[model samples]
Target: MRQWLKGLALFVAITCLVWVGVLWYWQATSRDMSPEDIALYLGLLPLVVFGLALLARWALRSAVASAVAKEAAAAQAPASGSPALPSAGQQERHAPFKLLASGLSCAAGHSAREVADALKEGAPRPAPDKALRDDEGLPVLCARIEPLDTAALQEAWDGVCAVAQADLQGAEAQPVAVDEAVQRALAALQAPLQQCLSQLAAWSERFAKPDADGPQAASAAVPAGLRVFTAWPTHWSPAERAVAQAWVKHCLKQDSADWLAPSQLRLMPSTQGGGVALWLEADRALRAAQREGLPEVVLLLSCQSDLSDARLGHLQREAALFTHTMPKAGVAAESAVALALADETWPELPDAAAAPVLLHRAAVIQRDKPIDAAGRVSAQVAEQVVQQAAAAAELPLAEVSALVSDADQHSPRGAELFSVLVSQLAQLDAAEDTLVAGTLWGRTGPTAPLMLVALAAHRAEMNQQPCLALSVDDSVARMALVLRPPAAAGAEPTKTAS
Candidate 1:
């Protein structure tokens, strides 16, 4: 009987353990995922795995090919047929430098001073009906450039180019050692883009409805206006095609640029390919300035009239960002901002008209958790970025006389941003004034940070004191830059572009 009882007890213990395990699993699953979700995961898992595997295979193949090529080149170099190494002078390089001159084209104002003044005194208010309140009951507004069409873009491009050209004399004229590979890539990309536009122009004649003039005029028009319904039959959308066509045309217009040089460094706007092409030629000019041993200037400009269509102000379906009645996380405004950089190696010019703007220091850091995530923003990364910038500038936080940021004052993100800034302010030398660039220019898209840079440059020139520019990108990187008047002067300006 005792042996039978022991066996029963053993079975009961085993049964209890099994039940406990099942209960624990169910509890976990209650919070997230169900049988339906399981099926969805199962369907997606294969694609994800396949993508990862494909990437790995490509990387392995590339690495192996590179290794084999390097071996072959090494083996060939000792032979009689191998070419000799190029001389140092034949290989060109450039270091970072400060801005000698700056130009801005923004909807906020024609120049940085106007934009700064307007930003401080308060920009004109948007129509009450146009503003949307976000999930947190904060209003978001946007500033736009009047007429978001090609003419506006071309004009803005011309204005910025003129500024850069005037300040960076001979930058486009500066000789560059052509990189054959880069030239080939540029040509390859440009050729396809041109062809795409030409095709669109041709197809446009067939699909477009007759306008006031006649059907014949449609041939001159690009396929971008065929309407989404009409353009859907084609592989790509009209909107995408229009952006590409505009970019390619813009590139071809920059005749002053050395076409053979490598593509220049560009600060990409907020999204993947979000008009990064807009700065392609400008990148070339900036590179030329670097090659010519000239002071570096960064120009950040944007006009957002194009974004007024949704009038929702760059809204997304975040639960907390929208209310049943309104969306408040965005603003509409225009802005033009500029900055002059100062490299430690370059001497500051004496007898300067005003203390030239100098980039005292800058820092960027990735957040542990994205600020845009569902959780409360830690802002630790932002604080670290600022601290690093201050440390590099050798200035205390108290000395940050002014603050410029792309964040609007009305969103939850804005509230978190201000909270972070306030916590940091207690550690600063003097309380700094805040300028929400977006509040003045509306959400300027990628121009948000550019506007901040421009504003800092303006304040540095005006107060002859340091200004701090802070910004966060969709990539979860927080950046802080300190702009101040040039500490000293150097040599005469180099040959500049007309």
Candidate 2:
């Protein structure tokens, strides 16, 4: 229509110019022209002028109409609290929550291709990835309201979609108004919108800096392991991001107890199920911070100490032969052994009366330096043993240091006791049926410094070595040693076997 109007205007202007020129030329050159000529020229001049005037008027009217149309468009635009255009594209960006505030009046879903077609207030059918099922597998269609006035919302939404595409295409240079689009999309997703809003808000809060400011600014949720201040890096490299994401996902799948320091994560062979498996991830945020310009990389394994007596014992034994066995497999075995000890039931032992002889044997060792009596090791010794354990396993030195340090804090005495006990424990290699004993007696009572000596001999079971018996009592206190020999030929062994 505009093009036609422009062409008509051009034709009119050209015709007027030609008529004026011809009339002027006749006036100048045809001086002796008759009355008819004069009348004709005069008559034609006014008509040409009239045609020019009409064209000018037409142009003016066209401009006025364009101005009025623009004003009307401005007036029709939706404002605050206005019913949003129903298309998925009309909904706001960050402000979908605001549209959702009033609650969606209507939602719809068609096939996969038509998914965003005409959603209204109710939940739509399951998407391609999902299956909405009754007994049989079929597309389940649902809506929150009945007899939907679909035209207004869908048509409004179609306009919204066009606008949204334009906005997204130039997001960097020109952003679209987010309010209408957000409302439309969320209204389409009415059922989960509120829940999604809460989650999104929480995630934003988690990632956003308190001081940062911007439009379209985003703060994606940090992984769960990173929730703690010390656990996550403030500035992460791309590699670190990948590793952290993988580890966090794995941790989330397991029981909470499996979660631990990132350094402690290891590829150790499992004793329970089968081959090797990854342990918990250790923290590397500190390391990353220290190496500012370096690419962030996770230390694959970190050695850690087990404070439990049983765990420490297993670790010590494993360390002795780690090189011979699969280092990874051995470390895994030791770790599993430690975990088992932690999970073991602390069932009450028999009373001293029920097994006096066994109790006597136990008491001999128990009456040592109060620390040693509990089968605990010393901090100094544990540190050394942990170092040895880490070296044997070929772990990073820093990791070993951490393990030893942790051991010192958790069980300061276990290591020293282990050191003392291991040697004496070896001496009773010959005895089985008969018991053995070791003493560390002080004058007034059990002393800070104690010694363990073993004595045991076995005649049966093909000459099994002697069992260890130790005592650490005060010199002033009377020390008595007794051994219950094996019952002759299966007489129901009186004392519980050690």
Candidate 3:
């Protein structure tokens, strides 16, 4: 009301000034006219000036409104020949998944704690690759993991082979031959997968033990069924994927068979952003499991490694996509991340040592244009996804304490993310709160998205605040979700020991 009154007063003052100027001009031009004629002209001037001012204001408002409507329609429109996404109502129907545990392996470190510590210190700088060079004869920069131990990888492979042999013996099939390429891929994935399973096993054991607090405390039994979802890069062949699946089954049977049984093993392969897709699949599976009254734990795992000369050479050859310029070109990197997710109704959830972080349903939207299309980069799609995800989680944008993304140093990706942060999540300090996994780990291929999720979960748990994870690596789509820390209990939330 105050603002409206102020605008009215200003309008009136401008109208009065215009009327006085017109009356003076009339008087100067009509020196022969009577005083009565001058008085009538002055009396009519105020009404005419007021009418013109109102008309101009209406025209200006109409123009502004029309422009806004056109911009909104363009933003919501899909690209030519692109399929329509699900309605917001349909997306909101998805239930939140409980994050029981997480595992990570990257150039910074092998364990989640180690990786988080390294990230906290500062942004990582990529070193020049000794084997790969760009068009300018300069070495390409990359963030490569340290070399793995040959003896241990071989030992693990032998066990997998032994398991494969036993299964084929009954069918009189030939022994599976080991390929060098398969070995290298398997080695890249081994560390994080093993670490994830070990942690899950330990958690299961703890949950099964009777509570020491009192008899009234619930003594929860471990779930009998397990569902594993694994994602590999598109560059890997079918044979390699089959072997990787077999290896995972063997590991579970050998280590977890006493308390858990594998019921389903799904393989998801994609050129990029496979980790985000894997999580979405897991959420769907959980909903189906609930409908069928099945109690099961789901494991989401993914890994990617581009440390080889062949791989780096391929990237270097793509001049349009990659260059030697820092913060403009992508750096070759490798990483692995695993997440153990379960329904909120799991029997042992309440008795767990730490409160589980909740993964709200993700919102994925198609871009109106391709990332490489000739034109200005647009942040509309990215902004829409983030807003939708936050809305689905019922979280206000101001409450999101940090932003984590798989966007590399590429200008388009960086610009898109920066726009979202500045416009939507202005509450966060970009330098102190934003974590770019790609800059730290380089382009980790399929593993980058999951790595972002893992890092967000860790940060949320530590700070007891919500963190947003964004997947902007895909060229055609953008995805975002909220990782919210559990609500505060009477005492403060426990922090992870350093």
lDDT (10s digit) by residue, model 3, range 287-405: 78876766667887777666665665555666432454534556667777778887766644455677778787888888988675669999999999999998777678998899988
TM-scores for all predictions: 0.48, 0.15, 0.70
Per-residue error (Å), model 1, residue 351: 7.7
Highest TM-score against the true fold, candidate: 3
lDDT of 2 by residue, 339-367 (tens): 00000011212332221111011111122
Tens-place lDDT per residue, model 1, 340-383, is: 23343434344445544666435666667756566665767777
List candidate 2 stretches off by more than 4 Å: 1-206, 209-287, 290-498
Stretches of candidate 1 above 4 Å error? 1-97, 105-107, 128-141, 146-328, 332-352, 427-432, 473-475, 488-498
Look at candidate 3 and tell me the lDDT of residue 393: 74
Ranking by TM-score: 3, 1, 2
Q: Which 10 successive residues of model 2 have the least lDDT summed?
A: 334-343
lDDT of 3 at 382: 93
